[model samples]
Target: MILSCIKRVSCGRIRPVLTRFLRASTAKHHDLESYLQFLQTQANVATESTYYKGLLYEYTVQHALKKLIGISPLTRCGGTGDNGIDLMGSWNIQKAKKKLDSLTILVQCKASKTKTGARLFREMEGVHSYHVSKSRQEGRTLLIVAAPSAITKQGFAQFQTTDVPILYCQINRVQPIYDTKQDTFRIDNFEHYSVVQGLLANHAAQALLEKCDLSTAKINVLMKGNSVEHKKASPPVVQKITLT
Candidate 1:
């Protein structure tokens, strides 16, 4: 029966030995490349894990680009009370002998750890355009949305939903690394969240700086959730700072 399908596919010729050999290898998971290629060609299978993995891959690529640009990536910057600006920083692009002035950015970190859609980007747009009114009037502004773990196809679609001029940052590949010597946990995908947040905030800061004819600027960090230490000897991870 299967042979008939192959015969029709291959112009009415059946190489029994070859057919048996291919099936045997496929059944044992030894032909992953072939299986994947088949899936690509057929376009019918929609596995959840495969979908998530693709999302992660796309986000990781964006994170890598932000890192190369010299943006001081951050995790979460804007607290619930603060406006939409979450993370802010600049890319110190090098020019002629001396380091060029940093290009400010504002980032919105999305750490939902699940698939996010256009509504998230649309919400950021609202915050950037109206709620956070300071950035827009200045002209040098950008709103960035970074999702490290998952970015659904719908979320990408949402990006076209607005003309708010926001940069999209998607981070995939979340791996936890424990450093016993340092007694600290560093997330490999931290840039994913921070870059998006930083780019958006940078836009606001840059505009303010340009208007003031200033070469440097800083951003305030706010958060809705409690700090890991919960206000003990150590301060909350979030704090205010002036960037130059």
Candidate 2:
């Protein structure tokens, strides 16, 4: 069947393979409810573990950022004494001709089930500001609260007043999608919960990007690189599973 699918592809027979594959895959999963239940189990495990939960959330955010923005972030574990910043990285922004610019980014990750309020945002802003000043580097800082919860309206308003741009990734807002034509399953609303998108669209975030001297060409390059990485890093479908 796989070989036949390949042959069909070479002969421009895309519709049949897509339809058949999607049907088979969807049948195996049963329905969205089951998939969501599995996700909920995973979430429960992450939340129940005290030590591993924060690490898991930080690593997940790091991986997501790499997949979504094409920039690798450094994770600072708690035991190592992370002076308030959880992740830090730099983006190589390419300009006209052979010129290259670098934007230093600092990120703080929050893993909680409750809504993030103004208090947390204020603390994050203060910590990020102190780090930037102490390091003596003119860098753009952003706080990434990756919780499976909402942000208080007051908290969001408070964030806007801060110098550092605050972005959010609410896991609950992510929706799973099954694409029949491509025979693929993925989180369709990941971008909607992405801090990177917030940075690209929000006025304050845009100002920060501009302050870092990122040109339109550089921004385009960054986004294009991320798109390629996302395709390469997508999770593969399980062909079969056996229970003992």
Candidate 3:
């Protein structure tokens, strides 16, 4: 049955459906790009001072993680912080007829024009190690470096060699596109999409989603049990057509 369906789609019988799907997908992509552009503009205007820029970077990382993972992270902004940890959060996993499990995540945000190198990664690892040792909380830790520009090849290579896991989120600068007909400036490139996609595809994010599946299943079962019932009505008599 699946093969037959695939053949039908391949034969272009469902070309209209495919076209509609593509259009809808493109519309969604455009909408997301517009939203990212708005956020970028806000960040650019808000981060005037160096201190404010760092704060904004941390806040952006926190916001993005919460929005993408549905988990609110605790942000440590000013003052002497816990080593170098910027944001920390946990995911609660519920199981049927089993004890609940929790997974903790630690994030470090960097808003720099220069690419992050091995030294930065080592520092983060040291900080995280100290934090875990003191707190005695054993869980997965992820280093998230949110930069306005791209990470250098050397920096990325350093990241790959680091024992600690890290996630790099590079926000690409949007290029301005002038519309001659409309006499307006349009923005191109939305790097936030790729950043969000990377976070969503991370192993930690997958674990969180897997845990949520249990909750979703339970909710679905409850919804099915409490489903609304419609009253049955009498059928009308069918009108027979006379043959000519």
User: Against the unseen true structure, what C-alpha lDDT does each candidate score?
Assistant: 0.40, 0.47, 0.41
**Evaluation by lDDT, superior candidate among 2 and 3:** 2
Backbone clash total, candidate 3:
0
Clashing pairs in 3: none
Once model 1 is optimally superposed onto the true structure by TM-score, how far is the C-alpha of residue 19 displaced, in angstroms? 69
Residue-level lDDT for 226 in candidate 2: 56
Top TM-score: which candidate number?
2
Ranking by TM-score: 2, 3, 1
Better model by lDDT: candidate 1 vs candidate 3: 3
- TM-scores for all predictions: 0.41, 0.54, 0.48
- RMSD of each candidate? 21.9, 17.3, 22.3
TM-score comparison, 1 vs 2, better candidate: 2
**Cα lDDT of model 1 by residue, 1-244, tens digit:** 1221121111122122112111222242222222333444443545456443443333343344444344443222333343555444444434444322434455655555676676787787767655334532224444556554444567655655565555544444454344668655443433422322222223333444444343222121212121233343232221212121
What is the per-residue lDDT of model 3 for residues 104-190, given as tens digits with 9 covering 90 to 100?
Answer: 555666677665566776676676566543343423434455555544556555555655545554433233354668654443222
Q: On a 0 to 1 TM-score scale, where does candidate 1 land against the true structure?
A: 0.41
Q: Which parts of model 3 have CA positions greater than 4 angstroms off?
A: 1-47, 93-101, 133-135, 171-244
Candidate 1 residue 187 C-alpha distance from true site, Å: 7.2
Model 1 ranges with Cα > 4 A deviation? 1-66, 73-76, 95-102, 131-138, 173-175, 181-244
TM-score: the better of candidates 1 and 3: 3
